[model samples]
Target: MLADLRLITVQEYHRMAEAGILDADERVELIDGYILKMAAKGTAHASAVTRTEQLLRQLLGNRALLRFQDPIRLNNYSEPEPDIAVVQIDPLDYADHHPTASEVYLVIEVADSSFQKGCGLKAKAYARSHIADYWVLDVAERKLHVFRSPSQDGYQTETVLREDATISPLQFPNAIAIIRDLLPKLRAE
Candidate 1:
């Protein structure tokens, strides 16, 4: 006999959180209707996230709202919490709901071990939603993977930036970020 699997929607995910079926301490995300546990953050991963957040804040200033380690509703079935998300300024403050794909300007994920998933499944999901820009900071490799031109198949453009390279977001062409500034400096033992 074949076993049946149940898929949960974004609404149900919120309800589960509100009803305490899911604890606030649990690091998990809904991807393709499955709740996947996020990997624990190592020192390098944590530092990179902090650095990226700081750099984006300084570059964007009041022009965009930067959300760190927060969930953005991708669609009816996915709400993956990105390391950083640049969203449009909303006067109402998104008080009623999370920013959807259209409101998002860019999404960044700091990947140590999650690099494969970030580039594969996560990239496909973001592309399906037509997210214009997606970036994956590969901590182990010390590089940045930039994805753009989203389509149903996936992002059409993929660019990998080394430590010495710099990148500017499509939304803010004038604001530039040195790729090295976003990665954590490893101290020699």
Candidate 2:
């Protein structure tokens, strides 16, 4: 029943994806040296990601690069692909290797079936690596929980955001995203 039997490093995982060892059709991701079978994107999950992406792309413009479902190298053992990641401005950064946590400005995981995993496991991993910011987009709840100020344990700041709220990146001063516009079909009630 297990698709991946061998433990692979971050580098190896990328190489495998690069070499077509795993096809695009395979719904899977590498996390903490283990290949995890990701749940198929339900309707709600896909909608959230789509709306979020549109808002982010327009807000960030040319200042930051927007990546969707891309693998980010956390470390030797961990390289989990977040739903969306705003990375540093670089033209050739992803040419030879995946972006490290140091290169990431923010990571967003749109959680549907993997809500616990995103809020718990991935949050800890991002924090341990000193990731500047992380957001859990709760599809079921139609809200975003922002996490920032990484410490030895976890993120120092945590805030819940609704559709009417505005979100600004910790790394970028001028960039702002309106939560309501980002969730077009979401109802606050």
Best by lDDT: 1
What's the lDDT of the predicted structure labeled candidate 1?
0.92
Give the alpha carbon lDDT tens digit for every residue of 1-189 in model 1: 224888889999989999999998999999878898898899999999999888898988999999888899999999989989999998887887899999999999999988898999999999999999999999999999999999999999999999899999999999899989999986761
- Give me the runs in candidate 1 sitting further than 4 Å from their true place: 1-4
| Over 4 Å off, model 2 | 1-7, 12-24, 184-189
- TM-score of decoy 1: 0.94
Question: How many Å off is the CA of 39 in candidate 1?
Answer: 0.9
Q: lDDT of each prediction vs. the true structure?
A: 0.92, 0.83
Model 1 weakest 10-residue run by lDDT: 1-10
Query: For model 2, what is the error of residue 42's alpha carbon versus the real structure, in angstroms, after optimal superposition?
Result: 1.4
> 1-189, model 2: which lDDT tens digit per residue?
466556788778768889999886888877767787887888888888898898888777888888899888888878888999999877795887788899999999988889888988788889988898999888777678999888768888889998678888888867788776555374543
